[model samples]
Target: MDVRTGLFYLFSVVLLFAAFRVITARNPVYAALYLVLTFFRASGIWLLLRAEFPAITLVLVYVGAVMVLFLFVVMMLDIDVDALRAGFWKHFPIAASVGALIALEMAAVLMGGFRASEEPRALPGVAAAAQAGVQFSNTKELGKLLYSEYLYPLEIAAVLLLVAIIAAIALTLRHRKDSKQFDPAQAVRVRASDRLQVIKVAPTRPAAPPAAPDTPAAETK
Candidate 1:
């Protein structure tokens, strides 16, 4: 096999192994790390397809932002491994059934690969267009579809994501007694006198000597 084909197989094998580990690993952190490895392998496959934009986007978005956030959450949270696994056997039958169904669906989808025809090469006119200084890019085609045909769908997706973000914030938010909140309107309306206080006091003075009774003074003398 050629170098490209060899690399593709190599990446695909590693990607599958990593993906399996992500599901089967005992440690959550290890599973997350394996997932990161899977993303990297997928990016490599994208690069092999000459889709630079998708490869870079996978690295920057999933590996950089989403995976880091996941890792941070996993590490920072307290999780009980034994307690988590205690009910695994109880849930395994259903989980396995669902997993099998998904696997079958994926297999059915991928089976089409054996029958799908290869994409035709560029037409003579298209080749001439390339020679005439028109740059060819899959990213350009993707951008055109995203902006023109998929624009409304994309906007709706963005709005849904935004709503989901707001909902998550609302759900996870706790009203902690220790957390002090400020009123912006009250702060803006405050004057110097309202913010600052001054206390007045008398100047320092020496204590007066106590006067003794007349009989006690005579006895001292």
Candidate 2:
């Protein structure tokens, strides 16, 4: 096989293995790590397919940002493996059936003799430039298309993601009575006198002993 085809198969194999491990691994952290590995291999496969923009985006956005966040979250969570596995047998039949169906569907799709109707026609300028072995700027082309044609959808998606991130932070953060939290604005405006108060009080002397006179008068009478 050609080098490209060989590399494709290699990356595909690793991707599949990593994806399998993501589900089957007992440790949640390990599962998250395996998922990150799957993303990395998938990105590599995309790179091989000449989809450099998507490949780099996949690595930067998913592998770098999302997966790292997932890893941190998974690591922070106190997952009890035994508790999680308690209902494994109970759910096994349904889960197994679903898994089997998915596997069968994938197998059918891959094995089915589905051929492309036609080789993809490159853009008017793209084909000529490609033939000259000149590197085409996929990122630039994608940016143009996205901003020009899909700007509204892209902006909406960005706003949605921003809302989701804020929601996630709000949900994860809690007000704890024991934990000390300070508002930055309040802190910045605070005066030294407001923060510290010193009071001077005159010290009181102890009451003098007065009981000795009563016994002396009784003895004289």
Candidate 3:
């Protein structure tokens, strides 16, 4: 096989192994790390397909940002693995069925895409740009589609993500009576006079001097 084909098979094999490990690994941190390896392998495959935008985005967004956060969370958490796995056997049958259904659907979609009669066709804009000898960017086309046709759905998704973030923060937030915290509104409304106070009192009278020790002459006398 040629270099590209060999690399594709290598990446695909690693990707599948990493994905399997992600699901089967006993340690959450290891699972997260495996997931990161899976993402990197997927990005490599995307690069091989000449989809630079998606490959870079997959690495930068998922691996760099999301997976790092996930790994940190997994490592930091004090999880009871036994408690978590308590229902594994009970749920295994359903989970296996769902997994099988998903696998079948994906296989059908992929096989349909690989039909010999189906040929790749360029987009209208891309074809026009090609005829005019102008360079057309898939990223620019993606941006146009996101902003125009899918704008509302994109906005809805953004709002949903914002809600999810707020929910996560709220859920993990702890309130401690022992911890000192000031209300921002109260702090903003505070005045100098409220913060500072002066007390006035009558001056204390000086204490009388202590009597001197009896002189030596008095002792002699």
Candidate 4:
């Protein structure tokens, strides 16, 4: 095929591989790195689609910010892979069902997009601007669409993100029996004696006087 199509396929293949590795990799750090790769490939695909804003945003937002944070957390945390996977077989059926449902939904959406027969129709203003040969900004148009048509969905997404942030904080801040939590106020007010102790014992015995070394006897001459 042409160069664009070739690049698209290349990015798609790498993206799929990286996405798969994100889920299957045993090391969490490797998984996060793979996810970063997935985002980069996705951004490249978006660039090929001529959606520059989305491509840049994907790289800057997800790759630069989110993936860095994910990598930091994954690397810092002592993740118990065995304990985490202990219930995997027990939960496999439900997880499989949910995954299948999501796959079906994605298939449906892709099928509908492919089946669309009509050419993409731009907004009336955008069409007029195009006819007049006025420079158009897709980013501006996207902003308008987000603030107008998709406002509710955008607000809902923000709320959901906020809820997720709160939930994560709640989970992290939860008290654990095994954790050695200390009160800062109590620690600050403590006396040195509470934290340290010094004891004196009588000397085992008085210091012995130094013994004088005998001079070597002069060689019998």
Candidate 5:
């Protein structure tokens, strides 16, 4: 077998194993680590496919940023493994049946195209340009395509992701009674005189000592 095919098979096997471990691992942290491994393998496969930009993005964005955050969150959470496993058997049959159904459906869909002879043709502009010696400068092409064709959808997706991030932060962050939180707007509006206050009080003189108690002879007299 060729080197590329050998590498592809190796990566595929590792990807599958890591994906399975992600679900089956008892420890949440281990599962997260396995997921990171899966991402790495997938990125490797993408690199082999000559999708360099997406491959690098997969590593930098998913493996570097998302998976690291996932690892941290998983480590922080106090997962109850026993509780998670308690209903495994009870749910196994239904889960298995659903999984089987999905597998069958996917198989049917994938196999459906096997008998088809014709493939869809690329657009004339794209095909003609590709046929010519014109090679796209990666970043420029990506920027042009993103801004021209997919701009609205990309912006909307970005805004949605930003909203989701804000929601997650709000949900996970708790306000403590001892924590001091300052609002910039409120601070900016405060006056120096309002922040400082002083009061003067007069001092009182000490009272004279009480007279000595009378003796018993003085009381008899």
Candidate 6:
């Protein structure tokens, strides 16, 4: 086996392990961290396949941004692992069956890849483009297909993800007795006049009042 095949196997194994841990880890923070590992491994696999765009995107977008955000949120929230695991065993059998079904489907797909004919039928456009001495680029082809054929589905997926992010933010906005909230509406409405008041008062005389006008002072006078 060559270095590339060895690297592929290494990354694949690690990726599968990380993915399993992501689902089964008791600690949410650990689960999220494992997910980051999974992304890294998957990115390595993409790199091995000469898919630079997807590899970089997986590393930069998921591992760098999304998974980091997940880790931060998981850590900050201090979620109870025990509570999360409370009914896990009760649900495990069903989850396991579903997992098995997915695994079998994946196995079928992978086996079919091995059974594919050594020669693939060629498309005229791709063949003509190749013959024209244009540099072969999977990334360019991916971009073309994504923007043309899969554009609508890609856009819908993006909108769904945006909605999910908004929903998570909304969920985290639960009223906390210790949390302080600043209403932008109230803040914007507050004027400098309301924030500060300046009152002018007549200066008091340095001398004491004239012995209260009467009493002992009037008698002495």
Q: How many residue pairs clash in each candidate?
A: 0, 0, 0, 0, 0, 0
Prediction 2 global C-alpha lDDT: 0.88
Q: Which ten residues in a row have the lowest lDDT in candidate 6?
A: 116-125
Residue 131's lDDT in candidate 6: 92
Question: Which candidate leads in TM-score?
Answer: 2
**Candidate 1's TM-score:** 0.64
- Model 2, position 35, has a per-residue lDDT of 89
TM-score of 4: 0.62
lDDT of 1 by residue, 22-96 (tens): 988999999999999999999999999878899999999999999999999999999988898999999999999
Candidates 3 and 6: which is better by TM-score?
Answer: 3
Instruction: For candidate 3, write residues 1-221 as lDDT tens digits.
Output: 99999999999999999999988998888999999999999999998986778999999999999999988887788999989989999999999999999999999989977889999777898899999999877778889999999999999999999999999987656567777767779999999999999999899999999999999999998
What would the per-residue lDDT of candidate 4 be over residues 1-221, giving only the tens digit for each residue?
Answer: 99999999999999999999988898889999999999999999998876789999999999999999988898889999989879878999999999999999999887866666857767786788899999877778889999999999999999999999999999987889998777779988999889899889977988899998766674433
TM-score of each: 0.64, 0.67, 0.64, 0.62, 0.65, 0.61
**Residue 216 local lDDT, model 3:** 94
- For candidate 5, write residues 118-206 as lDDT tens digits: 57565555577688967634545677889999999999999999999999988656577777767768899999988998778788889
Q: Tell me, by lDDT, which candidate is best.
A: 3
Which residue pairs in candidate 6 collide? none
Candidate 6: regions farther than 4 A off: 116-134, 144-221
lDDT of each candidate versus the true structure = 0.91, 0.88, 0.92, 0.90, 0.87, 0.87
Candidate 2, 3: how far from true, in Å?
Answer: 2.4
Model 1 lDDT on a 0 to 1 scale: 0.91
Q: Give the per-residue Cα lDDT of candidate 5 at 63.
A: 91
Q: In candidate 4, where is summed lDDT lowest over 10 consecutive residues?
A: 212-221
Pairs of residues clashing in candidate 2 = none
lDDT of 3 at 49: 80
